[model samples]
Target chain A: MTAVLEVEDLTVRFYTEEGVVTAVDGLSYRIEAGETFGVVGESGAGKSVAALSVLGLIDSPGRIEGGEVRFEGEDLLSMDESELRSVRGDEVGTVFQDARAALNPVYTVGEQIAETIEHHLGYPPSAARDRAIRLLDRVGIADAETRYSDYPHEFSGGMCQRAAIAMALSCDPELIVADEPTTALDVTVEARILDLLAELADEFDVAVQLVTHDLGVIAGTCDRAMVMYAGEAVETAPIEELYYDPKHPYTAGLMSAIPRVGDDDDRLPTIPGTMPDPIDPPPGCRFHPRCPFAEEACTRTDPALVDPETGEAATLDDDRAAACLEYTEGLSGGLDYSVEVAGGTGEHVEKTIDERDEGGPDE
Target chain B: MSLRRFVVRRALSVVPVLFGVSVITFGLFHLTPGDPVSQLVALNPDVSAAEEARLRERWGLSGPVWRQYLAWLSNVLVGDFGRELRTGRAVSGILWRRLPETIVLGVFGWAFAIAIAIPAGIYAAVNKGRLGDVAARVLALSGVSIPNFWLGLLLILVLSLYLGLFPVLPPSRLPLYHPETLRYLLLPGVTIGTAAAASVTRVMRTSMAEELNEEYVTAARARGLPERTVVFKHVLRNSLVSVVTLAATLTAGIVAGSVVVESVFNWPGLGSEFVRAIDRREVNVVMAITLVTAVAVVLANLLADVLYAVLDPRIRYD
Candidate 1:
């Protein structure tokens, strides 16, 4: 399937007075048409920066040091500001984090949305007004006709987010990049918003790139997931494969950290150590210093992703590789050195390493 | 604030304040050491106490001080500001003649200032560290520092003496009431207006620059709105509350600030008339002018509060 959006080896940096701080480093991903692609990472992992970089929205001092971002076969980086602006609201809509600040306080929400319609769709004033009301109703704003005359401050937080969504959808764009769109909302509101977005994406046949830190959200809502660590994509897999058989240790740690409903006695597992600074990353493998399975080789040399043998599609098989040295075959585990017959290739590798380090398992 | 509540609250609040001001101004004029009766007799020499008393009573100075103040305040409340002491003309008639000229100079000056300052501020803010930003900052700094009165004199010397625009002094009995000579008001109008504009522009630029950095503006751009729309529409209006508040106060500032400018050009507005009244110690005229100015300031502030409620919905009367 052809990708609707393709980003390759993207690196973003800010040249501050102190030094250049790398915000996003060599991250790559592809989103196919009509798919919900999720980028999951903790705060400061550069998920929002990557999203902003796609729209050419990064200001001075923060520069796209390297990469190619192509949307429907067009190089977004090569386009001038005017050309880029034409594509921004017309072709790609954005639902920002805070809905309240996103809408202007002075004007009515309908008027603001109508402005977008008029700017992109060339509708006359009266038609634009009608279209704005329709869009607001579609977002579930009640009394759409009379509410059109009300200012933004009159609406509640959830209502403001709805208004923001209405404004975004005014131009009927092909893609929507929502950066933590539901973070500031309560859980009930969050569920409704996600459902609304999923329904809208399906109905409109538009692709979505949802950026969030919630592992459960990505697992439940996204078709595919990409885990970002220290500004790099460590793993990308189908959501089912990612949840049930997470390959990367970081992904495994993330899954173990999720609070299962009835498991109240024991604490949820958490990875130790704060998120590393991106300005000057730890040498060799960026995750080595924090990885529990780190060996001498893991610290001395970086490991590139390799296709795991229990593979799916050819494209996905290559896509699921992890940057861990233990994933390599024959280097640390072999027949003469290995004693126990493990159940699968991945289990065999983990057992052999565990046995070697612990001397022997209990009888 | 509700429209009715706002209007009534503002109207009621200003009444007692103006009454108190009238009393103080009336008392101060009477308390001054020099005797206005002696000054008037000395000037004319043939006038007696009977003539002085007639002049006083004509200007409504015949009653006790408190009674006179109450009478004047009540007259003003009923839209009758009595008559001028020297000319025996209605005060409202005088204001009708001079208020428009003051407003004309003020509006045009403020418009010019907003035009220059907004773009300059945006340019400086957008190009924060570049040469253009530095140039704009320097210009704004100078605008804030330079006195408007001094600038008015400089404009007179440069534009009037060298360029020989209209006469240094505006035409006596300005033909503003007529249509044919309207353009003649341009130079004097510009002189006063530009001085006020320079200060207002600096204010707008500072406010605009600060507001451009707010997260809402960033949010607007992140939504894929054009850069210009984000700056001009989103950030500009949010930032303008301060600018408007400052501009509202300018009605009073320009009136007060225009004293030197008006005197320099002999524009025959209240400011120039005020300087003459003070010098001659025309107690009744001075008290009348002070009362009028105090009312103008109080009314301007009241208008500003209403405009504030209209421009920003977040403010409430409760």
Candidate 2:
């Protein structure tokens, strides 16, 4: 498989009145052709900012300081405004976090999609409208031809997201940056939306950069995933590997924190401490304040992403890599954690990771 | 179909509002210390008490407040505004003659306000806090603060006296629809529209600025839409909803401003007639003008309500 987008050493900054905030620091990731790449993290992890920077969408007071966004071998960052405009809806489409808010209130859903089609594909309004209706119907909006003239307010949250998804796919772009596409949706609706996204990504042969805070969302949809914490990726691995055997302590904490359906415990195990302020982050490691496996060295040594096998610096091609002192400078106490996959076969009741064996599920 | 229903419902709702306004005007007239008959008697010293009594009976001014209001309302409904005390001329006829002039002036002012305010507001919003925005804001501030009477005089002084652009007297013989009258309309139009333009510009700026930040704008931009399309097509539509709301209120300003603006322009409009009627205490003429102005303001607000539903799809008139 070939890489469709290669975002390297991306750094985004916001020049706020208080101070300059380094929102995304040296973030690096890539999405291969037709592969769903997940960028999972807690809130304020700079997922959306980094995604926006790919399209050169950062406005005043916020700037994309440094980045090489190579989309199909072309450096998008070097492109001028007009050049970027040609690439935006033509080759890359974006679905905003808030689907309803992302849709223009005054315009009909079909018109909004058709307009992008008209602009990017050079189709006339009639052709664009037909294409938009078909796309809307394909995205699962019932009576899409009739809903063609319906305004955004007339659509429910789920329907709006479906329309937004339809819009993203309208131009037949090579890539889609869905920034928390299901965040504002109902719990039941989120699953169906994710399924639709994955199905359409495959159908349209488009790569997706799915940004979400939900690990379960990534686990079910993404082929490969990168776990980000405090604006930095701590681990990058295949979805199953990341879930079954998390490399970073933060990822393990996240995996363990997923509450099980049948678990008797009222309190869900959580990763302690909040995301550190971007303006003035901790000295050594950003996540050390919250890491349960933090050693004395973790407080002093800032680790770069390296291979666990050879402890050498990992390249973009490396499938499994982690940025921890254990993988780089080496932790004195050594890192150890066991993942407990409860139940048998099909759907599991509980699958959580914690320190030590702690025994398997009694059931 | 629903839009038509909404329009009918909204239009029907205006009846009660206009009736209430007419009632208030009549009640105020009735509650005053001297009745119109007595005032008329006082003005003409040669009038006998029997003649005054006959005038009172004829005018139905001897009834209670509600009855008086109803009597006045009944006459007004059928376009009978009584007759001027001094001239003994039909107040309705005088009103119809002056009404068109005021309507033209008001329309010109309204048009001028929209033309200047919409563009100036869009410019300021698109280039917020920049030099153009700052300049537009300053101009808008001055437009709102400066009184129409002062602005009218200044416009006449400069455009009529210094620049030689227009004459002080409005074109009298030329039909108002004639092109020559338009040139004469400009001075007072600008004078009346200045405050409204300023008021609307501020609203447009704030409304556009807010809409510019909405996610739809960024979404539009993300779709490879030219920056122009994002700002003009998407942002402008959302911003106009607020502008329409403010437009309704600015009508009051323009109407009130016309009163002063008319006198300064020496335009034969209802506003100038209103001033004369007040000065001479022509109770019939004054009451007719006041009721007309009140109805106009009520209608403007009603128009705004209808426009609000049209501009924003979420607004349903249930």
Candidate 2 per-residue lDDT over residues A1-363, each given as its tens digit: 899999899998999998989988998888899999999999999888888999999988899899799999999999999999999988898998899999998888999999999999999999999999999999999899999999998899999999999999998999999999999998999999999999999999999999999988998899999988888889999998898878788888898899977889989999888999899988788888887667677778788888877899888888898898877766655556667776466454554333335332221
Quote the true-contact fraction of every model: 0.50, 0.87
TM-score of chain A of each: 0.88, 0.94
Query: What tens digits encode model 1's per-residue C-alpha lDDT throughout B1-318?
Result: 576787788789988897788778778877776555566667897898799888767667667867877786687667676665456667667666766666665565666667787777677766777899888778777776777777777877887789886567645565556653444455556656654565666676677777776666766675557888888788777777887788777777777865776787666677776788688665555666778778888888888777777767665444
**What shift in Å separates residue A45 of candidate 1 from its native position after superposition?**
0.4
The digit string of per-residue lDDT tens for model 2 on B143-181 reads 888988888888888888999888877445578888888
Q: What is each candidate's DockQ, to 2 decimals?
A: 0.49, 0.79
TM-score of chain B of 1: 0.83
lDDT of the candidates, in the order given: 0.75, 0.87
